[model samples]
Target chain A: MRMIPAYPVRSVLVLLAPCLVLSLWLGMPSLVHPATPEEIGLKIATEASARDDGFGNFTATQAMVLRNKQGQESRRQLRVKVLEVTDDGDKSLMVFDEPRDVKGTALLTHAHKQEADDQWLYLPALKRVKRISSSNRSGSFMGSEFSYEDLSAPEVEKYTYRYLRDEPCGKLTCTVCERFPVDKKASGYSRQVVWQDKDELRTWKVEYYDRKDSHLKTLTIGNYTQHLDRYWRAGEMTMVNHLTGKSTVLNWAAYQFRTKLKERDFSKTGLKRAR
Target chain B: MRDGAARYALALTTIWLAASVLAVEAHAEIEFAAWELSGRVSLESRYFPRTGIDPSHQSSNTNGFVLEPKLYVEDVEGRSVTVLPFFRYDSADPVRTHWDLREAYVLLFGELGENEWEVRLGADRVFWGVTESQHLVDIVNQIDFLEHPNGKVKLGQPMVHVTWTADWGVLEFFGLPYHRPRIFPGQGGRLRFAGLLDNERVEYQSGAEEWHPDFAARYSHSFGPLDIGVSVFDGTSREATLVCVPPACNPREISDLSNVLIPYYAQIRQFGLDAQLTLGAWLFKLEAMHRSGERNALGLQQESNATELRGIGFEDILGLYREEEYVAAVVGGEYTFYSVFGSTADIGLLAEWNYDERGRQALPRRQPLTLDNDFFFGALLAFNDVESTEIKVAFLTDASRATRTLAAEFDRRLSDQWSLHVESSSILSMDPDDIQWVGRRDSFFEFHLEYNF
Candidate 1:
């Protein structure tokens, strides 16, 4: 119950209150300068996808360290090659390189935008290539916390987006958005919440909601480095499966962009020979 | 003699290990694309709590070891050569000690017509069926009897494979040149009959015997949710028909004879269709086959046992009265419930109903030496963690015999390269008269420690 100065102070405060309220309300939404929330989400997603175009192909080596609730750890190393397809989704091949039981194991993927992706697994022990059912994509990847759907590259057409909010996440201003998977039959998730920075349009964090609408996993990306001065690739990505009390950390190194990768390299014929 | 073979196998494994290590060291400075060596060595112990029916296996506890050394070499053009030599030594069963060249082949893969055609030429092992309990349609490789009773292991088959992939689907052809024979237990093995199977008595319907030519063709395609594969094979049957000495034979002659069962390989043709549909977490599968000239020379119907010979004693050679054609089918499904009982582990339940048209087992259990209609149910709880711990439980029941075979397995990864496994299996039959059949074998518990290198 502190009393205001009657004449000058009250009049000045009353005059500036509406202007301050209007500025606060209008300042946040107009930062990115989009028309609607959905528009903003689509625009951001499109920008992210567009910003990553014209890299041709890339090859990367990664180390995956898995840990359980008891702090027990296991490690695996693999090489990944991705080819950019203009009309359809990308074609990628992953070859395992460590832990003798699974050494020389490989997976080749031909992702499509509309239909289920075709995937083949070459088990070194069996010495044959096996085609896995795309609809049965909920199995763990190499017994890790990551599922097959989680390891796949997320395409722009794979999800429908809606903007949630704008907030400052750590140092960067991030736009929170919700996305629903387009292929409801194959994807194990019902929806996902993504946080991408406004400056680089790179994903900072994501929360996965499982088919049962339960919060299942959380993925955080960090230590990003710009490749070819345009494409942003995260150096470290950690995925924590909340329900399972297990986590997988992927540390990527030696990313070579614009590598000469052909369609033959991703075919099933080359799966067993991949290294 | 067993000790000598064991020592020789051990020395061979040691020599291969040393040579692989030396080769790796020699190529240390060069790029690793030239060659890579990887393999596994496991030591296993089996303990039978119950006294075995077979007096030959008097020792309840036994120890064994297996060394599988595999080498993969790649040329600059991506053509690869895989050499895997497997050796196992089991002290309890002298016949189980053996060595095999599991894989020694050069795989040449190529694509033509703008990726529309692909060919794979090599000696390899191929598994064709999708069922978890039994593989009803797999016939490419001979069953490795010592590996497991469930027929999950195989011996390599020399073959050429070619596939044509187009907008319609994939059409594949296989030409099998070398047909290998299945090995049965030699005298001292468990789960075998009172006497050993005399390989000398092996008769092939085709006069060519083991050198018969086999060929297979398959067409696979996907129509929406359903994936289908239709296959046809012309070859000697992998399933062997038993030729036994009549029970009326004199004890002196029986004592003189070493064979309680003689494998008769029949020349047959098989047409099969395998289909699977996946919708959400449910998987429905079916496998159907019709065999022409199946058991055309067999003696029994697989369900009846006669203490008295049908029309003759030991004077007449026992053979099928006429040519027979039969069909078999298996229909099953798997339903998975994720986060079952509010836990992170997933539980899957599978059911399979197998029907054999030639099998007639509606009456009481008088067991013969062939297969019959049955049902199987299996469950798997996978704890996908850093350890990848899992437990599998399954049971197969023959209603006519009122007997069941139950199995349970637990596997745990101790470390990145180390693992421990325990498995138990038992057979229980309702009919006391069915004591002398396949499922009547004594139960066993197997434990193993494996180290992957």
Candidate 2:
């Protein structure tokens, strides 16, 4: 009767306790030792920043194919020319290439906390550059399944996150996190839970929820390949709207970075003369 | 007019001959035009069991077809024009009559000074309401009352119209001189006319007829996301009736004419303002109108004619002057939910309240309560890339009764160029006591194959 249990819970705790303490200590480089979730999140954020800094600038060509349940299909091709990156891991201007009709389309994201991002679209048919209001970012982009909010650059400040667990995604270990959108007016989703590779920082999947707190859409990124010396980009991204029964797929290829693109290339005046 | 037609034909012949002579030289120039053809065929079969008035059973089946062909010619020497023509054939029964018509016209658009203008000289669909499915006051088309119970209005007359569009608004003027009557053929092969002057008891004088021109103006402005429009138009009367006609021995001689009295020279003048505003997920609309009819001269004439017919004095049929005015206002709103229950389920609720002032002399002064509520809920499910399903439910409630309709459709994409659709609709009423249903009660099913080019 005095024999120990086959799986001793006390021994398991003893083995995990020291490793947890050491992880906490390493996670908080700013401190000697820490145990809070925020400290680990900061460490993860720092690592993400470091990885983004190594990527510098990027330019790529992408093709998007959309298919409905009725076998209706639509395809579009776009060329992305990114200009600059900051130490905070923010991309400056990402320009488009052929089709010549949208050659001048550029997206500039000002990542900041407690403020809305400013955006603009230059329409060749109207021959005018119009400022896109921030309130409608959740609307569909050109009647596509992808929302304008999804197309915009994802800023860390736009969401508050909490690391959930370590899970296996394919052959790699992933960090699962639940993120809530800070700006209610700019997003139709109340929150999103995403899985990203721990070492590569490549996003694998995300589950989106509507304002009513219901599951709405799911996005999956796959077939990631190293674009530049340090940059890892996904070759295919698929987004599915659960309610609408619609899906959009984006396939990316031919990526290049840091070709000495100038700020003048992203100017409003230059946009009119892009083609 | 006959001589003018001959002259025009001769001139067209000369132009054709000249164009043929120059065809060889112009053969090197390649010209291309966009052409489109669309057609629709509808067949309906109905069986009504004996109810109330009818002792024996009655059933009817009808078939109709419409073909529309459009040719758009643009950038021809830097000019643009579009020609669209439509043909329709409708038959209800084998022994019943068949109606056919060529419906359409071409439009030539050009710039006059700084404003854009268009001249349309043939039968065409006129633009009036923003919502074509349900029109509150549009009265242009003479529709088949039996086939389309909701469309009791008349169609627009054939007219040559000129429209001018500017930054301010649009103005149109129509010149209509001829009145075409609808003819209905009975089983006995006798043709009967349907119009104001269709009765043989009336006589219409020749030279007394005059062309009536209708003029309308509309102005619209956009304030933020809201669009507001105000329109005014003049109501024109054109048809004249004859009371009676006597037999004539000589074919060329004029027959004996009976005294005719045209009923009420009703001239209706109307003005309306409509506004549509969108705020967030809600759409709000408001419409107000004031219609007044004056000059009851035809009523006076009818009284005098009746007195004469009865061999009475004019004083006996006096007291027939009763003018009427109508004022109505409606406000409606619709709210749409973009997402519901983690699905693309959209729900729209609409409520419209209308207040109308019935004519003072018209019967049924109680004026049925014009308040109505409509609700719609739709859901779409995509099973895969080749098949989809959609379901929609609509509920309409008025002061008289409440009706509910449910529709479901499944679409299967067979190929890149073809798709198959199956749809069904069912309707039911809320109140069993108010069961004088004029429309179809049984569900309807449709199978369609659609091809896109």
Candidate 3:
């Protein structure tokens, strides 16, 4: 009702329409220029880590099956408890249950961001606790395809990342990225390539390259389940060694989150009673 | 009388089995879930390629079987109980065929003002040492030498153990009430000394004898790359002094009584320090101890316990020892090469030096003197494979006396519940003056197959 002149209204529309069109074009996924590959890679990793943060603590039981080229299989069972640390890497305790010869053996690890981790092994037969050298990160874990480094909690500071490309993965689009390990001397691999979903940032697959830059192994993760309405956890992981014609499959079950685990429970003194 | 006692034991065992069966039937599901039963059974075969020097014990082959059953029970309130019994039957050695209560203990865990505490009651085995070449600080349990000459097996000791964990370190205190005597090989056994050694011919310096109360305490802590422990023990010495009582007093007398060896236990106070430093792929270990109130070297005109010998002047007569204080130490290091030759197997080299101030006069003269003023070199191969295989070889030698020992051991899992072990050792002595020359031909090989459930 207050409009006075049609010429003023036409001039206002002409000035605002170009600005709206320009903003829409810039926001378009196909036309927009993304941030740098390194920045994007870090951003994705950080987001993925943040989503799984604040879990406080969790416990899970794992069963591993190892197969050789001759199709012979061996099995191992273990129970793991993890405690989340707000300022540092998480703490974990693993107790073996199979291969009855070492039924009550347990391993405790205290991970750090920029320094070597602290590890201890409890031998039930001897009732002795021994501190293991953390420099053997590349050594096989329980004679499986997974190395100690592969099984450790993936802390963002332990690697340098760069975004490679995005591709279709399974039923969804995934962002591909490459990461270089920070501890070159201890790590068996020079670099690893990861494929993660764009929506929830859950990792789907990874390829490991040996120090000589040859593809050494491939790990595929699947059967993701949501916990606490926000956190996603993989139920199964399979690792295959290309050079050795060997493979190991890990099946995780009975996951309980936020079980009110205390820091004192993860101490080296508690290792003997971990059973 | 022995048959009557055996009958009585059989009846008691039958009653216990009946009661256990009744209890299981009464609380089938409730108790079954809380109680866990598991253990190992092993079959072993041994062969001696070389004949021993003792003509009386000339057996070159032997076999044995061992059974160990364990029962564990835990409650939700941080209380648990464990019971394990061990039994072995040897085909040729009577002294090696024995039964023992390996462990029967109740453990209680609790927290006190942010500090954790634990208490253990009953019989248990506690080992404390970082060095592999010698366990100088491990004195809580008596060695079961009759089982193996390498001295790795131990007898359970009755003790009241308490552990307290604080921010500074872990403190452990033990009150041991019973002392188990070391049993020597029988006449039918292979690794026997040149004597008619009998367990009945044992003496103790303390009047209280095997009932003497023993005490030990240890404080252990870890700081980054280093882990250290300081321990003190006041108890009867585990090593028995070999004494030859008169009329076996004279060294030149070839009398029948001279062939008998008496084991004498002495009271001792030992202070021990053990430490290990782990850097990269290297591990450095050291164990040192200073002991008092135990006899040292043999000397002339020494006081003897034999009343007949006391009347004469030369009481030393190879039967007397003078009590003195001495220090012993073992230091070693191991360097590992992981992922060797682009393979998953890891190889490690180890070297250790053992020093004892008493030298060749170390009280346990009847046993091999491999750790006194000797150097040990060893290699360990760990094959990180599905079978979890490992091989270890060690060589120990005394440069001055020319006494050497070469040993090798290999073990691997044959299946999920079965495993195999093979061990061999050879000894060489060039110095006839060395006591080790008595059994220079005691080289042997052992094979073991174990099943676990």
**lDDT of candidate 3 over A136-169, digit per residue (tens):** 8999998999999999978998888999999999
Candidate 2, B31-115: lDDT as tens digits = 4444333333323332322221211212232344434343444334222233333233435323232322223333444567756
**Segments in model 3 whose C-alpha atoms lie over 4 Å from true places:** A1-34, B1-33, B193-196, B247-258, B297-319, B363-367
The best candidate in terms of lDDT: 3
lDDT per residue as tens, model 3, B1-453: 112322333343344345544554475433323678989999998898987665565688889999998898875554667777788888878877887766777776678998888877777788788877767888998877778776667777777889999888899999987777777777677776434455766677789987789999999988988999999999888877666555434433322323556667789999999999999899999999999988653322224433345444323443357778999999999999999999999999999998888876663322455467888899999999889999999888885787888889999999999999999987755355554445667788999999999
The DockQ ranking, best first, is: 3, 1, 2
The TM-score between candidate 1 and the true structure equals 0.80
Maximum-TM-score candidate: 3
Off by over 4 Å in 2: A1-187, A191-238, A241-246, A249-275, B1-33, B38-58, B76-121, B130-134, B139-147, B152-211, B237-267, B293-323, B359-453
Candidate 1 lDDT, tens digit per residue, A152-217? 878878888899998998988999999888777567789999999989988999999988999999
State how far residue A124 of model 2 sits from its true place (Å).
Answer: 26
DockQ (model 3, Cα): 0.60
lDDT of 3 at B362: 60
Q: Is the docking of candidate 1 incorrect, acceptable, medium or high quality?
A: acceptable
Give the chain A TM-score for each candidate. 0.84, 0.79, 0.87
Stretch of 10 with least lDDT, candidate 1 chain A: A26-35
DockQ of each: 0.25, 0.03, 0.60
